[model samples]
Target: MTSGRDRLIEAATRLLTESPDREPSNRELCDAAGVAAPSLYHHFGTKEGLLDAVVDRAFGAYLKRKRGMLRTGDLVADFAAGWDLHIEFGVQNPVLYALMYGTRATSSAARTADDRLRKALHGLRDAGLLRIDVDTAAAMTTAMAVGCVTQLNRERRRADDPFATAMRSTLLETVTGLPASPSEPEFAARALVAHLEATSEGFTAPERALFQQWLRTIADTTRTVQDGQHQ
Candidate 1:
C-alpha cells in the first residue's frame, strides 16, 4: 500500500493537473487522494506544501526516465532514445506537465525540483551530451516536444499515429542537428561535449568568466541568424 504522504502527493498532482481554472482547495485534494483533511495538513502543513510535493513527484518521474536511457553507446542514438522517452512522458502525463509548468505555488519543493532538472542537464552538458551554448536550443527542444504533445492532446489523436511519428522525426532532427534517417549519425553529441570542455577550459577564471563570454557571443550570433531567417 502507498504511504499517506505518497498518496497525498499523487492525489494533489491529479487534482492540480486536472483542474484547469484554479488551484484546488485542501478539502478537494484530500478527497481526491482518499485522505482525510487532517492527514493532508499533518503531512504537508499547507496546500502549498501539497503542491510542492506534487511537483517533486512529477519531476522525479521525468528525471528517472531521462537518466535510465543514458548509455555509453552512440550519443546520437542515446539522444534519440531520450527524446522518445520525453515525448512519451509528455503524452502520457499531460496533466503532470501542465501542473509542473503552470502552477504558481511557492514551495521550496518546487524550486528543488526545477533545480534538479537544471543540474541534470548541466551534468549532461559537462559530460558532453548536449550543446554547450544555450541560445534557443534547450528552449526550442522543449517547445517542440510540448508543441507536438499539445497538438496531439488537442486533436485527441491516438499515440501510434502518423502525427506522433512525424513529430518525433522533427524533434530528433531539430535538436540533434541531424537528418531524420537511420543511417546518418549527426555527431552532435560528440561536438557538443567537445565544445563545452573547450569553452570551460579556456576560461581565465574559475568563475566561468570565459565560458559565460563565449556563451554570450554564441547567443548573439544565434539571435542574428534567427533574425535573418525572419527577414
Candidate 2:
C-alpha cells in the first residue's frame, strides 16, 4: 500500500545502493517500482532530484539510528556504542554504506551525509562525552570502526576466515589508545549486536538470508581458526 512517492523513493534507494556507477533511467526505476514515469517526475522533478531524495532518505535513516543510540552521558560508553553501530551498519548493509559513504559517484552526497555523523560526534565532545579532541577522535574512531567492518565483509565474502576477534582487539587498542585485553571480545560482540539492531533497514528478505548464511560461515571459520591456533 505504498504511495507513488514512497514507491519512487524505494526504487531510487535500491538503484542507488545496487547500481551507483550509472544513473538509472526514470523509466527503469518506474518499472521497478511499478509506478509510471510521470509519477516520478511529479514527485521528484528530475533524475538529480530523485538522486538527492535517495541520498536524503538513506542518510536520514542512518542519522535517526545514530541519534537513537546516543550514549551521551559517558565518554567510553558513547565511543563504544558509536563504534558498535558503525560496524553493524557496514556489515548488515554493506552496499548502502558503500553507496552512501564509500563510493566515488556519491562523494558529494557522502560528504553531506557525513556532516550529520560529524555533528553528533561534535555534540558528544561539547557534552564532554569523549575525552579526546573532537575532530581527531571522531576521525580516528570512524576510520577504525569502518576498517573493522570492511575487513569483516572481505573475510565473509571470500569465506576465507573470521578476523572479528583480532579486528576488535586492534580497534580497541588503536581508537581508544588503550591496551588490548581479553575482555575486548565480549565488548565487541555486544557492539556488533547493537549495530545490527539499529541500522538494518532497507534490507530485503533475500539479502538478510544471505547475510545470515555468511554469519554462520564466519562462525564456523572462527571455530576452525581458534582450534588451529590452540593446536
Candidate 3:
C-alpha cells in the first residue's frame, strides 16, 4: 500500500494535470488520495504545502525518466536524450506541466530544474562543442525548451511525433553549433577514441593510457579556466 504522503502526491499530480480546466477541491484531493482531511493536513500542513508537493512531484517524475538513460560520455547525445525526456514529460502530463510552467513566476522546482539543465550545458561548453558561453547556452536551450513545451501543451501533439523531434534537433544544432547533419563533435570524439584504441598510435602503453586520459579531459570539459562562471 502506498503511504499517505505518496498517495496525496500521486493524486494531486493526476488531478491537476489531467484536468487543468477544473481545479481540484480539497475534498476531491482527499477522496482521490484516499486520505481524510486530517491526514492531508497532518502530512502537508496546509493546502499550499500540498500544492507545492504536487509541483515537486511533477518535476521529480521528469528527472526520474531523464536519469534512466545511460551515460555514454557523449555530451551531445546526452543533451538530446534530456531534451526528449523533457518533451515526453510535458506531453504526457500537460495539466501538471501547465500548472507548473504556465505562470511566469519561478518556483524553487523550476529553478532547480534550470540549474540541472545548466550543468548539462556547461558540460557541452567544456567539451568545446558550444559556440557560446555556458550561461548563454543554458539560457537559450532552456528558453527554447520551455517554448516547445508550451506549444506542445496547446497544440496537443505527442512529443514522439516528427514535428517535435525536428524542433529539438533544429534548436540543439542552432544553440550548440553542433552539426544538424553528420560530423557532430561527439561522433568525431567517439571515432577518434576507437581509432586510438585499435592502433595504439605507435605510443608506449603508458603513453596511450595518458592519451585516452587527455581525450576524456577534453570531452568532459569538467575543469576549465572559468568554470566558476556557472554553478
Candidate 4:
C-alpha cells in the first residue's frame, strides 16, 4: 500500500517531470496524490520541505549507482569517470538536477558529491599528480563542472557534448599539470616523498612527519620558481 507521504512524493515528482517549466501548486499536488492539502503540510511542513524530500530521494539513487562504480587505481581515470557520471546525471534528470543544484534548496547528496571530489583530489595529491593544493583544485573543478553542466542543461544538449569534455580536460590539466616535463625537479621531489611515506618503515612518527614536510617545502619552492619562469 502506498502511504500518503509516498503518494505525495510521487505526485510531486510527476509534476516536476511533466511541468518542468513551472512549480505545481499544493492543490495540484494534493489532487494528484489523492491526498488533502493538510496531509502535505502534516507530512512535510511546507512545499519546500516536500521538494527537498523529492530531491533527496532522486539524488540518493544517483549516489547509490555512483558508489557501485568500479575503482581503478588510476586516480586520473577515476576522477574523469566521476565527472562524466555527474554530467550524465544532470543531463538525464534535468528537473531534479536543477532543483538540487540550480535552486537555493540544500541537498546532502550535493555535499557528499563535493566531499568525494575533495577525496579524489587528495589521492592525486598523494600521487604527486596535483600541481595545486587540494582545496583550490576542488573549488576550481567544482566550479568548472557545475558551469559545464548548467550550460548543457540550459542549452538542452546531450551529456556527450564536446564542451563537457573540453571543460573537464581543461580543468584537470590546470589542476594536475599533466604531462609534466621530465626536467621538473618538483615532480621528482614530490614523487619521492610519496614513495618514502608509503614504503619506508625505519623512521619514527615525528621523524617521518618532518622528513615529509621538508620534501614538500623543497617541492613547493621549486614549483614557485617554475611558475615565475613561465610568466
In order of appearance, the predictions have TM-scores of: 0.59, 0.60, 0.69, 0.73
State, as a TM-score between 0 and 1, how close model 2 is to the true structure.
0.60
Worst 10 residues of 2 by lDDT: 182-191
Best by lDDT: 4
RMSD of each: 13.7, 8.9, 11.3, 13.1
lDDT of 3 at 7: 93
- Tens-digit lDDT track of model 1 for 159-221: 445786677677556645555542212222322333444344544565554544454455445
lDDT tens digits, residue span 1-231, model 3:
789999988888778766778778889999999989998899989867888878877776666655544356657776776777677777777777776775522767877888888888778877788887777777777777778888876877877676767787887787777755322343334334544564544898898778766765554453232244445
Per-residue CA lDDT of model 4 for 1-231, tens digit only, reads 999999999999999999989989999999999998899999999998899889888877777656744443557756766777778778888888888876623567678777877888999999999999998998888788778888998998988697887787787789887742322355345544644554457888888778877877776677567668979
Candidate order by TM-score, highest to lowest? 4, 3, 2, 1
Give the lowest summed-lDDT range of ten residues in model 1.
182-191
Worst 10 residues of 3 by lDDT: 182-191
TM-score of 4: 0.73
User: Of the candidates numbered 1 and 3, which has the greater lDDT value?
Assistant: 3
Full-model lDDT for every candidate: 0.59, 0.61, 0.71, 0.77
Error of 3 at 219 (Å): 19
- Candidate 2 ranges with C-alpha deviation above 4 Å: 15-23, 70-73, 103-132, 157-176, 180-231
